[model samples]
Target: MEPHAARPLEGRLALVTGAGQGVGRGIASCLAAAGATVAVNDLAPTRADAVAAEIRDAGGDAFGLAFDVTDADAAQTAVGDLEIDILVNNAGVPPGGGRPNRFAQMPPEDWQLQIDLNLAALMRLAQLVIPGQAERGWGRIIQISSGASSRGLAIGVAAYGAAKAGGEALIRHLGVEYGPEGITANSLALGLMEGVGRAGDPAVDRLIRGVPIGRLGRPQEVGEACVWLASEAGGLVNAQVIHLNGGTVFGR
Candidate 1:
């Protein structure tokens, strides 16, 4: 990576949940590129270690922290005593369309799972990381959200939309409460990103067609936003959900 003026995050330690693959992997790499030592956290040890190794091989500093974010005990253990300056709460698992059936057909278990993975775990991390940020008088936390939080989403995904929206609101609440302490929290609202999970599904093509950019969003673009938000250069950026949906909201 070429040198730039805003090395605001150099020497900072960043812990990114869900750093196993896709957008999470991209964000971890972006933070590392900015000279931060990244803790690549993920539920899958193999994916987490692989991403961490990639960062190290690229001449960046990184280590893997493997655990399920939804597990409170595991979260405390994996993030035990971290005086981290940045946190990217990006771990999430899609319902895989099984729960996207009509509301009447949707299973209660699937809805609960979505809520647990996307919303519950994020709030837990905020609780875990805030005290340290408050003590430091300077820190950043960037939550990864979905564009569906504000706009319409896929069929039967009402629960996911609601949960993501709630998480964004939490980011705003923390941003306001901690701003005086020099800690800023923000969120990135994303749309259809290519090359990951159901993102490449044919059904998603219909969603992509609505994007003015005429293509799916890239993981790197979303990662860059997280990197900026976690850096000191973004000191004034707090409590905002910057949509990276490539104009897909034109119809919304």
Candidate 2:
């Protein structure tokens, strides 16, 4: 067998948003390792360039593209004339970055921010990439969602959950509508993750204890899942919400 035979994503170009740190960074690294040239996007130019440099230092092909995913003009120009075979929507408001407010207490403006960041931004990028993908007759759309999309959280992030759910719904429709054109749309509803999960923090012990796997999900693991979805092996898995929450009951 050829040494590079295991690189299923060879010759593909992947664009990963918010890839400066945390989950996005992990995904970008993994995609590059899987033989895909990656375009790392982040709001901060330094971060995007840093991650792209890391990938190249590791002997992979990548470049940083700094732009806010929510900005329509910026998002459009970022992908101009580039043949992106895979699009990983990983940019969004961090779980606790937004003030926690119940729907009743959340001001309309605050909730609207959630919708714009989590769902609308995703739609914008998809709109920009899907046409080219269709023309090529091969594409992969991987959405990084949250467990809150499927279950209610008592933490006052109703808007966040709703926005994620909305994105998933869009993914379902896209999967069905474009399946005939060899494009697959899928959502990965993630559970608590290592970097994002705040593992070892006493405050979240109860949440950790609830996980059957007795651990937190790793960002690298999420990247591995993306590789599968973007590879030939995942051709048939479309419009499905796959959970990556360490066997949480909510996932089941």
Candidate 3:
């Protein structure tokens, strides 16, 4: 038996949204390490550039892209010309920045923002890339969803959870629609992560205790899952939601 080799994603081009930091950045780095050329995208230009530079410094191929996923025109302009083999929809806003309200009390604008960015943005980006992918006969779409999408632990993020649920459904439909074209659509429902820059917070202790693993998931773990799904190893897998929550919630 021979030792397994890395670089399974060699010759692939990946575009990861909200990759300036957190899980997105980790996924970009992991894909790059696996020999994929990555486009590190974020709403802030500087953040995106920094991440891309970090990847380059680590001896990987990557570039920065700053664009709002919610902006259809900007998304089209940013991605229209690229031949992306993998798309990771990781951009989204968490609820409750002095705006924590119950579903009934939440403002309409807040709901719209969540839906537009979380659900609609994924659909729009998929539309833009699906054609090229279909033409080439290979593509991977990975949605970075949340545990709230399947559970009712949304609390103040009712809208966000709702949108994520919708996104999951859309991913399923896309899988069924495009599986014949060599495209796979799936989602990753992440729980409280250690690499979201929120490690060591006392507030997260309870959440960590709740996990079956008794710890928060690392960003690199999520990245590894993304790489596996994007690689040839996961070609037959589609329309599935892989929950990366360390057994925080199950039975979906």
- Per-candidate TM equals 0.91, 0.94, 0.93
In candidate 1, how many Å is residue 19 off? 1.1
Question: Which candidate model has the greater TM-score, 2 or 3?
Answer: 2
Cα RMSDs of all predictions? Answer: 3.1, 2.4, 3.2
For model 3, the superposed segments whose C-alpha errors exceed 4 Å read: 1-5, 94-98, 195-201, 250-252
Clashing pairs in 2: none
**Top lDDT prediction, candidate number:** 2
Q: Give the alpha carbon lDDT tens digit for every residue of 1-252 in model 3.
A: 111357888888899999988888999999999889999999889999999999999999999999999999999999999998899999876422325469988999888998998999999999999999999998999999998898885467778888999999999999999999999999999987774336576766766778899887878998999999998888888999989987778311
lDDT of 2 by residue, 58-82 (tens): 9999999999887888888888678
Per-residue lDDT of candidate 1, residues 1-252 (tens digit): 223565656778899988889889999999898888899998779999999999999989999999988889999987868878898988766524335655567788877877888899988988888898898787898988887689775566777777888899999999999999999999898877876337567767776777888888777887788877876667789989898888776211
Off by over 4 Å in 2: 1-4, 94-96, 197-199, 249-252
Model with the higher TM-score, candidate 1 or 2: 2
The per-residue C-alpha lDDT of model 1 at residue 250 equals: 27
Lowest lDDT 10-residue stretch of candidate 3: 92-101
Error of 2 at 208 (Å): 1.3
